[model samples]
Target: MTGSVWLVGAGPGDPELLTLKARRLLDEADVVVHDRLGCASVVQELPPTTRLIDVGKSPHHHPVPQDEINQILVRGARAGHRVVRLKGGDPFVLGRGGEELRSCREAGVACEVVPGVSSAISAPASAGIPVTHRGLSTGFLVLSGHEEVDVDQLAATAFTIVILMGMYRLPTLAPALVAAGKDPLTPCAVIQEAWSDRQREVRAPLSQIAVESARAGLANPAVIVIGDVAEGV
Candidate 1:
């Protein structure tokens, strides 16, 4: 009675953003291992029979470590339960789906990946800013704000820069860009909780994004867009 595992993307913050396959998998999953950023509506709708495991992690804290999460998935499958590793954003895009996938394979558990819309593009669009706009930007770069960011590389690129999990680093992001040769007046926008009711945005010059974002009291689960397309709100 051994079961299988699914690495499903829950999309940004909105439940409606979920793919049909993701919804179908959720309905069939006997166990769901979710993150803190996963949509509440989706989690709340799971049948009472569904076993929910909250392995949500934040920048400063991780209630469930990665090793434990991997073990939980493998153990659940071995016990004959359909397991779903529910993550926010696309599983491959900074969601750490790769590690979990490798874990399942090593444990001899069958696994499948279902992709979802990434917040890197969705968050900016939620604010009417395109990551790449004809003359505005021909390309874009997505980076992690939770770890070491190469400010010099960022300053040298004209490509639109989208940074995820950057709220805590906002205070230094802009100043570093300036020091690395980026224009102080470069347009920047911070989108908080994209596609949800709590969604809010802060638009400012590169030099002022930190102060403006602070004034707005923007918190985690945010996307920071830097480019001409994000200018003027």
Candidate 2:
């Protein structure tokens, strides 16, 4: 009688933003494996009897590799424990929830995904920037800034571009967008620690966003919004 695994999204750092289903799963899970960006309040609210496994990873630092995380989930389920893989933001949106699900299925473990609000939209909205508006933007693109994405190609799109985990890459990304024909004066905003008490935002033109962000001493765990929507126009 193998147990099941639940891949739960912790939303954008706000405990209250957690979905009812996610909260219920957290309380009922026998073991919770969480990431670094998970809501602190929710983690603290876990029942004392629930086991916790911290697999948090920082940029360029993976203390618990993804493979190990998958193995941990498989083992927990095999032991007949209700396991929850809690991730920041929507698990499916650049959180690698799909990979974890595949791992579970391969191991014959039943898995479920409880989606939560993604920072791609929630982060920008917290700063009063809608990802899309009637005339500002008809649609938006959500991308991970953790890799070598093609800013040039992305610049050609009319949709608002929301970049997650891109604070560190802004230096190159901002310039690339400008060089790729995006208006140098296009508005951009960087929201840090979205939905948290220490949340802050920095707005600038696409060409100067990297400089402004540097001047503000912005750190990781931030989202970057590029295009007209960032100006809240």
Candidate 3:
């Protein structure tokens, strides 16, 4: 008798941010597999009898590979245990929830998704900035600031650009944006460890973003926003 899997989003880093459905799933889950960002807080809500598996993936490090994670969910479900696959922020928002969902479907594991507030919007809000304002920003774009980022295609898009997991690629991005004819003085901001009390925000223009970020010593799990919307904060 195969059990089911719940693909739950733990929401940013706050346990209180979890949905009621997610909370219920956590309490009922016999086995929980979680990411590094929201795992610590989620575990605090679980009963001691529940089993916990740490599959946290941090920048420059992957504690558990994706294949292993897929297998864990399938194996646990096949063992007739209610499995919970937890993630930070929105599971589908760069969290690879899509991949996990594909694997589960292929293995015939029943699955469900519980949405959570993504750090993409919440992170900027923590700094008092709005991704979209009445007049400041008509819309915003979210992109990965990684080396593989398509600077040309991204620049062509008119929405305010937000980059995730791109701290290490800031140097390349800054220059690319400028070369694409974007205003060198366009307002930019980077928020580190967003949504946490220790969150740090650094604001600068496109030309100075890389330099400013380096000087501020911003690290991974940070979010970058490029547009006039930042000034509206």
Candidate 4:
């Protein structure tokens, strides 16, 4: 009676951005395991017959650990329930979808992945900034805001840099980039609560982004874009 698992990306915080395939899977799944950041709107529209489970994790507060989440999917599938692991943005893009996919496969369950639009690109777009442009930037790099990164390596590249979950790190990130030779006046924009009703944008130069964001008191569920293309209005 083994069932299957689908690692579906809910697409940023906008249910409207959800792909048709993702929507179909959600409609058909017997159980949906959703996260806090992404699936709030989508889950609200789920049919009552479909069971829901919250595995949402926030900055240091994880009620359901990774190991536990893995077991939840495996167990649900083993019970012959079609388990859907719904995450915000693309599951592969910093969503830890790979780990969950591996867990399902290792446990002898079927698994499939459905990609979603990541805020890395959409967030900047929401702020009218493109991560890549003809002359401004030809490429972009997406990095985790929670992890330690090499400032020198980042400074050496001209590619646009996109940082997620980095609101609190803004105070140090901006200065480090400046010291590493990245232009102090590199155009930067932070999209807060992107795609939602409360969405807001903070535009500043690399050296002043920290102070600017602090003054605005911006919070997480944010995406930061740093590059010439981010000449935000």
Candidate 5:
């Protein structure tokens, strides 16, 4: 009989942040296929007999493409292995969990998603910035910084804007928001490696955050938050 697949979220690089379900699944999985951002401590918890596969990707470098990863998951399930597809942050929040789920179903595999805390919110929260607050932010928006997005629309929203994978594009993104009518002095912050011991953060106005982040030597895998909520503790 074929086995099942579980798309588990490892939760923003902090093992303690993992849900009980995710941790239990990790312990029970016969094989764990994980991404680069997965918590080291959590991955280390796997039994010695559990098979491991690394499919981590870096900016502009995909050592294992998505198609190949999907194939691997399908193959593992067909082989009757209880497969765990471990991802950093919430699988549904820009983790491509939906795509993987669709692939598994197409291949006749039984699969389930176990949600985890997303870095989009947790990163900023770790820096003491609330994404929303009463009378401050009524809502929040999350966007991927990897593609061309409309800064004008984003600037026009009343929601706090959170950008994941945005470190590399801060120069263009910051200026675009300003040009789109957002206040140049709008509060902004960048948080790197949130929830980890090496985590770092930088706060500044919208116009200067890109420059401030550069001075701090922030890199990818960081989250950028913009709006009044960014100014709050």
Candidate 6:
């Protein structure tokens, strides 16, 4: 009797944000693999006999490699233990979930994906900022803050830009947007801990966003929005 793997999104930092399906899976999982970003509290809902594994990523902190996680999932499923592979935000959105799904497929393990609220949109909404408005913004562009991506293209092409894990790259962002022909005074805002009671919002323009973020001490699990869509709030 081979077991199955469930890739569950734990939602942006709030345990209460978990989907009903995710909650049901946690309650029944025989083995649970989770990341640091997702609320660990969800494990509390699991049966005491359930096995828990943490595979979190940090700037310099020690963390389990991805391949190891894949192996763990394969091993547990082969052992006939129902496995729940949990992650932060939506599993398909930059969560490296595709890799895990491929691993399960190759290893002959049945797997399913459960969607969760993404911080990309939730974080912005938490700050009372909308990514789109009737005429302010038609849509939004989502980007990774850690990659060495071309900020110019993002600034020029994206009406409302949402940057995940981008606080560290703020110093170079403004100049890049200016070079991309985006207004230096374009309204922007950064929201932290979306859907959580501790959430905070900082509003500024491209010209001063970096400076304001520094002053406000805004950090990770945060989202940055650029354009007039963020200003109407």
Q: RMSD in Å for candidate 3, one decimal?
A: 1.5
Predicted structure 1: lDDT:
0.90
Tell how far residue 163 is off in model 5, in angstroms.
0.3
Alpha-carbon TM-score of each model against the true structure: 0.97, 0.97, 0.94, 0.98, 0.98, 0.94
Model 1 quality (TM-score):
0.97
User: Who is ahead in TM-score, 4 or 6?
Assistant: 4
Q: How far does residue 204 in candidate 3 sit from its true spot (Å)?
A: 0.9
**Worst-scoring 10-residue span by lDDT in model 5:** 37-46
Q: Can you tell me which runs of candidate 5 are displaced by over 4 Å?
A: none
Error of 4 at 153 (Å): 0.8
Residues 1-233 of candidate 3: C-alpha lDDT, one tens digit per residue: 99999889888787778899999999999999988885677787799999999999877788789999999999999999999998988889888899999899999999888888888888888888899988677888777655486677776766788888889888888899789888888888999988677789899998999999999899887999888887655
Better of 2 and 6 by TM-score: 2
The sequence of per-residue lDDT tens digits that candidate 6 reaches over residues 1-233 is 89999999988877788899998998899999988775566676678898999888865564788899999999999999999999888898878899999999999999999998888877887777888888788888888887887766776775788888888887798778888888898998888767777777888888999899889888876888888877756
- Put down candidate 1 lDDT per residue, 1-233, tens digits, no spaces: 89999999998858788999999999999999998785566798888999999899989898888999999999999999999999988999999999999999998999999998899999999999989888788999999888887889889999999999988998987899999999998999999988988899999999999999999999888999998989732
lDDT by residue for model 5 (1-233), tens: 79999999998988889999998999999999999885566898789999999999888899999999999999999999999999999899999999999999999999999999999889988988889999989889999988888877888988999999988899989998999999999999999999888999899999999999999999988999999898865
Question: Which lDDT value does model 6 have at 72?
Answer: 96
The sequence of per-residue lDDT tens digits that candidate 4 reaches over residues 81-122 is: 998999999999999999999999999999999999998988
The local distance difference test score of each candidate is 0.90, 0.91, 0.86, 0.92, 0.91, 0.84
How many clashes in each candidate? 0, 0, 1, 0, 0, 0
After superposition, candidate 4 runs with Cα above 4 Å error: none
